[model samples]
Target chain A: MELNLKLNLDASTLKADFPLLGREVNGKPIVYLDSAATSQKPQSVLDAMDDYYRSINANVHRGAYYIADLATTAMEETRSKVQRFIGAASPREIILTKNATEAINLVAHSWGREYLSEGDVIVTTIMEHHANIVPWHILCADRGTRLRWLNLNVNGNLKLDDLDETLDGARLVVLSAMSNVLGAIPPIRQIADAAHEKGAVVVLDGAQFVPHLPTDVAELGADFLAFSGHKMCGPTGIGVLWGREDLLEAMPPFLGGGEMILDVTTEGFLPNDLPWKFEAGTPPIAEAIGLGAAVDYLADIGMPAIREHDRKLTAYALRTLPGRFGDKLNIHGPADTSERGGVLSFTFGDIHAHDISQVLDGEAVCVRAGHHCAKPLMDTLGVTATARASVYLYNDESDIDALADALERVGDFFG
Target chain B: MPALEDLYREIVLDHYRNPRNRGELPCPPAKRAKGFNPLCGDEVIVFVEVDEGGRISDVRIDGQGCSISQAAASMMSVSVKGKTLSEARELERAFKTMMVIEGGGSPSSPADLGDLAALQGVKKFPVRIKCATLCWNTLSEGLTTE
Candidate 1:
């Protein structure tokens, strides 16, 4: 594979760090283009968890023993690492949950239920994964709050012309910073500012954005940010929910259990501090440590370089795929790479995405073929499903070339 | 890893490309059932018009999905049309039984399946068994309502 010398980041070299990327599938080297689903873990991240279990295997925050204290310190260090990773004010503002889904649910159940009332408006977008949308749906149903949508334009960008009107009387505005399907990077800062102007809290779904781009909660103007660890080369079963200090302090506890309570009483219980109030049970100790290592690994490479790589690779795909397939292929999302990330979603003729994916799999190329968990966006685009090929730091031009080469066979096989 | 050829048999592709009895039948005379594979967003709507003699006088398949799902529905429409309700049920049970068997079970009697035997290749790809069975499930639901 010839490396593109013009690229800022050496993806070929980066691929070596991820052990899974070195393996083969179907008798050929794997061309993994489904990073948006979940990123491949680096050896460092795997080793971090392995080391924790080997050396510091103990329960966190409860045991009085030296190993337990060490475990608790390690977990707290990861919390501080995450706090700095997203530029949160303090470690207290960062709450750990099962995944991004649980993070959003915590906000919906804790903050939403306490602040919102009947007839209150909660604004969201069509491009949201089911994680960000379903919680609000349940919240609205429970509280009798109205859910308003911010629709997308022809280019898959949010139509903000009616922003003030939509944000009118809205108590909260929830949306994704980067779309999982189209890789469209919406202007979150602009929307967040507008929501703040209307006194509506902005909840940014950073599952796609945090992994691929440089993120600062303050710069993005998000009041609460939610993202998963697995999507960013960290292990699964761990996610982050960063909220404003005051907001988290004011909200009621989400799950009432062991760690969340400061003192239990026969009558009532006192909730713990800012973050511990949200994290109910024994936390994901090693997983959080692994995520900290992932953060360190990404920081060593630098997010700016990663962002640049994503832009250049996405541009190459945006150009090469259509340039090769022509009218037969229809790439959905923004035509401008500046407005997009590394996610490439498209449809080819009448061929179902499943068939396209199956054909691609023959050559050891893995691509996601489904609605991409954005059914409202699928409805808006008039497609039941799309074949999505999302690039990550490990993917390069050769991978894209392999994808195109395999896609050509799809036309041959199905034509 | 089964070859794509095993899943996309020539007969399956033939049915997918040129689907038989495609479209909807009038509701007054025909019963309708819709099936959805929420995982992939594949939908199948099966409509059947049963005669007074308990025979499926007409059947039509309407929906969009992968070649496997669309082909399965198309083949099902052809196989059940003009057949007695009891005969269609027997075919559904036999087809489902074949799907569950590992490595595409060789039916005790291949003569019983006819072209449907080609779908036995589907069992090789476990995730896709749902795709092949979606139409039959919808048809079964429709028959139960009748």
Candidate 2:
């Protein structure tokens, strides 16, 4: 079969931007296909972080020195960039957290505890990553709240037919815009509208969606959106939790220390204003700067182009793998590429995912194999684990060809 | 490229394809234990029947895992089925010593391990040592449990 490779951006020139891609694994060139786990940072992001440390390193907000002011500016600039990247209303709505996991936890602890109570139902999907699932589970267990799960259809997307009924008594609905395992992009706008009609606030986990697709917070109609910098070519320690300005203003601070408090008297303390109220202590200043640089880099390339690249790559994989491997490979997700991102999770023959991962490592093909931290989704799919191959802007047809070649080797070696 | 022959040795594949002592032992004096490797969802349930003389009269291994894990379990069952409990424990120690991360050379020579020595290649792949040792760990837990 002919390969219809529609690459929006030239990977050859962009390949040099990520230094790690030039390195070798084992004896062969590293075929890094695990961008869903974490993308390799560009030299620009690294240089920006290094520049921050070299020139403008200081404590944010509290310091009176020149460097401190510059540092604060850099940090806030990142917040604005993130705001613009996701199309949030204002910078005041974006709260910096350690990671996406921490961001979700912040929502669960601050918002869930404050607004939700006994018998208050919160709806989440079967395909949510552990970060989104566990926090609500803990909140429900603690506050006597009832948790409802939206099931997956045969296509691996959330079955929204029963969503309105499920959201009837639900006070909140937290859903991922995309599945990390199945790569299924759900109808976030429709889900959000339905939840709002039922008087429930919607929280979208944009960790998988924001990096691969164009995310407009207002357009999506979600009250809160959370994502990490690491998955989008920045450093690991910084993440953004963007909430509706009104919602963020109403909720209490998640963490408290030096910065989050307006005044800490002996008897009591007053909380700081929006964003800062949620961000306590010294934040990830350097990582935030790096994230801003990464955001700038993505903006230069354009999210539309990146989205197209991902869809075309996903289309290529979906069309090629099954035709080549036939029944030997079983891919999980929507059959159509338009319904999913670039992530492909599958099993080759009866070989377990761990084994496939190990064998692929022989070919320097770095794919993720495990539950993908979505155990409930794994249960629904009737598999314990699957090997996931995900693509980003830097990847092209050569990477996919390398992957297919390695998978063929895996098939033959195992046989 | 990584040397595939070292990892997927002929004997290892044989045990994986046609595992020995797989299934359940009837209850009465038999004891069963379940173990899970949450990393890759490898689950093994070991059933052991110990005789009055403290020898393992029969041992059955049942699990679903990758080739390495399943093969390791199969080899482990074959190695320790007829041996006394103490002897099984000694072999377990030796096997773990072989799978150790640092200087992972076999403690007991190849002659000492007999058929189980085929798994010595697992020591090279650090991530896979747990897969090789899962059954042995499960067996230890099974024997110790009342």
CA lDDT of A264 in candidate 2?
90
The regions of model 2 sitting more than 4 angstroms off are: A1-7, B101-105
lDDT of 2 by residue, A112-174 (tens): 999998999999999999999999989989999988999988887889888778889889999
List each model's interface RMSD: 0.9, 1.8
**What lDDT score goes with residue A139 in model 2?**
96
The DockQ of predicted model 1 stands at: 0.82
Compose the digit string of candidate 2's lDDT tens values, residues B61-116: 98798888889999999999889999998888888877774345558565667778
Off by over 4 Å in 1: A1-7, B101-105
In candidate 2, how many Å is residue A254 off? Answer: 1.1
TM-scores for every predicted model: 0.97, 0.97
Clashing residue pairs, candidate 2? none
Instruction: Give the number of the best model, judged by lDDT.
Output: 1
lDDT of each: 0.91, 0.89
